[model samples]
Target: MLWFPTLSKSGFRSFIADNDEGSTGKWMVPIPVPDIGLIWEEIEDAAVEGRILAAKKSTHELVRIIGHNLACVYCSASDPDTVAETLRTLREIGVDGELKYKSDLATFDGREEYLYSSSEFETLLPRP
Candidate 1:
């Protein structure tokens, strides 16, 4: 199973794009994770740069550190209670933001599809 870290649009683009640091330091580029096992090491590496920290610490500490910029979408592969724990921790820390779940729409024949489920969808779609 793969887990995608939910980040802001800019952060997501930055995470996927290649960058060069000019002549000051070596260019640090993000690499795609081919396997889930590499996630921990990658998180540790990012933590060193202060981008994010591992959640091995207390929930309170982790919540305080994560703040309100974004909340990681608890992956389906994680324990069922993981999302609840994260939400509880976030609430305890008084953080503002939503904990989202991964979802998709697909046809029975395996074709991928995208459809708006919100009330805005009705307003946006042309009336037949």
Candidate 2:
């Protein structure tokens, strides 16, 4: 899933609540955006195209359009080829950023669950 650094902790929690289907076994695979920031126009365009692809190719909804920076894609039941195509389009538009991954704990349903960490996500700098 694509996650914007600007999202507050509450906002992030809200996103999880909205997207999760009460599945305790789920993991948050957050792909962070680096400090260079994204090309918003390109991202918006890609999201529209992705939505179109999801409509024809996915059994479940894939694209979640919040804004240029807040969009998320739920790829659980989507076609890999379509996801690849969307990624390729991002690369073609020079929308590149380093993705960070970390594991942390969160509470869901009164039970502790593992969630990929997003600490310092907004401070990520481009690799030198």
Candidate 3:
């Protein structure tokens, strides 16, 4: 299955460096957006129901990607203890104002930090 390159080449290079252990296979493979789009349905599971609205931090001068992908929201939900909770969880995750977070380097720091960095004895300052 194809996945979007959500980071820049150099950015992705760094991502590969930092994430080498978690993944395996070719370290670098660049594909154009149109080419990647060819396998959209397979990667995102497009076709069962509602479309997929991806909120990834874009690369290649793009923003969020909307695909025809659909999944059993029940299957993808994190805390799917009950039918109703599972159904409503992701269905309204975007509009409900419920914030879920993951531990990534950038998220740990403010957005401003990701754009610039300084290593003057381990202190990072704002670039304003």
Candidate 4:
């Protein structure tokens, strides 16, 4: 499962994608926006199970889960400390991966917009 974070009027939004073949046969699942604690709990759980592929923040930060090649894009506005803490936890749990920032902010204004990140980070997502 992959968790993609985005922002909404209510709060943070996480869209989960079950990538297993024949599992629900859906591309993504929209889950209820939980508080930061719950979000981290979920991440920890996924990490323990070794099922997380990637995680993204709405602030344009992306975390790619090593080996799995899963890319998670976070789209919610978050404080630096929160971001740092999350990354630290991931690292402590042995979820090795690189953190990437969006390269072109202007290109992310709409759903049709293609996501482009810095050269340091590679994305499985295609460029528009």
Candidate 2: residue 56 Cα off by (Å):
18
Best by lDDT: 4
* lDDT (Cα, tens digit) per residue for candidate 3, span 8-91: 212222121233122111101122345444332332232223232122222433322433221211111111122223223333
Error of 2 at 9 (Å): 31
lDDT of 1 by residue, 5-122 (tens): 4322223211111211110111111222332334334433443443432222123334345431222322122222333343343333333332332221122224343221123222
Instruction: Quote model 4's TM-score.
Output: 0.31
What local lDDT score does residue 54 receive in model 4, on the 0 to 100 scale?
Answer: 35
Worst 10 residues of 3 by lDDT: 20-29
Off by over 4 Å in 4: 1-44, 47-68, 73-76, 102-107, 110-128
Better of 1 and 4 by TM-score: 4
lDDT by residue (1-128, candidate 2, tens digit) is 33333212122222223223322121122222432554544454544554312111111123234212223322222223333443444445554553222111123345343332223332342332
User: Residue by residue across 1-128, what tens digits does model 4's lDDT show?
Assistant: 33344322334333322221111111111222333334445553643454433343322121233322233423322233333343444444433434443212222322333222133222322333
RMSD of 2: 12.6
Candidates ranked, most accurate by lDDT first: 4, 2, 1, 3
Q: Which stretches of candidate 2 lie over 4 Å from their true place?
A: 1-38, 48-69, 73-77, 99-128
Tell me the TM-score of model 2.
Answer: 0.31
| Least accurate 10 contiguous residues by lDDT in model 2 | 52-61
Could you tell me which residue pairs clash in candidate 2? none
Alpha carbon lDDT at 86, candidate 4? 38
